[model samples]
Target: MDRRVYGAEPSERDPGPKPGRAYVELVGGPLDGMLLDVTGWPPQEVVDGAVLMSEHGAFGPGGRSGYEPAEAVAGAGGVGRFVWRGDVP
Candidate 1:
């Protein structure tokens, strides 16, 4: 049987980039160091941005972390970056 690992982790620990899977690195803000899986999304959707909810965010209950697509990094295994805009109430 083959052993495999799943879910988000620091880039340094990753074996390599996964083909056919798209990811966005959540930079800064409360949800920093997190990877958002955006697989199967078209270019436009990626640019549109995302608002993810976090129970542990600064605002506590009903808090949302907003992110906008930023420059793509090749060294990050082609993983795109999403800069934190701000937290929404």
Candidate 2:
């Protein structure tokens, strides 16, 4: 795997992957271009999707980003994709 940090500050923001941690790519929506850590995620949570919070969002911050699992995309390493559902205030 390439495993290169893409955007923001890895240590302070994305934090990509650590020794035992894993992450999924967030596609579209306010939290687009972000990586979500799913290292110890429950099997059901990965399947059912997740609602992530963003301090900096489309509406200027402090909103929830809804995402659902989608088919894996190339370069995403079969880690799956999180397609945007919507944002909640």
> What are the C-alpha RMSDs, in order, of all predicted structures?
6.8, 5.0
Models 1 onward score TM values of: 0.67, 0.67
Please provide, for model 2 over 1-89, each residue's C-alpha lDDT reduced to its tens digit, 9 standing for 90 to 100. Answer: 33433244746653455655456778888777666767677676777778877666655566777898886433333467789988787
Instruction: Please give the CA lDDT of all the candidate structures.
Output: 0.68, 0.67
Candidate 2: pairs in clash: none
TM-score, candidate 1, is 0.67
Task: For candidate 1, give the lDDT of residue 14.
Answer: 61
Least well predicted 10-residue stretch by lDDT in candidate 1: 1-10
Q: Which pairs of residues collide in candidate 1?
A: none
Q: Give the poorly placed runs of model 2, Cα more than 4 Å off.
A: 1-14, 56-59, 72-78
The per-residue C-alpha lDDT of model 1 at residue 2 equals 20
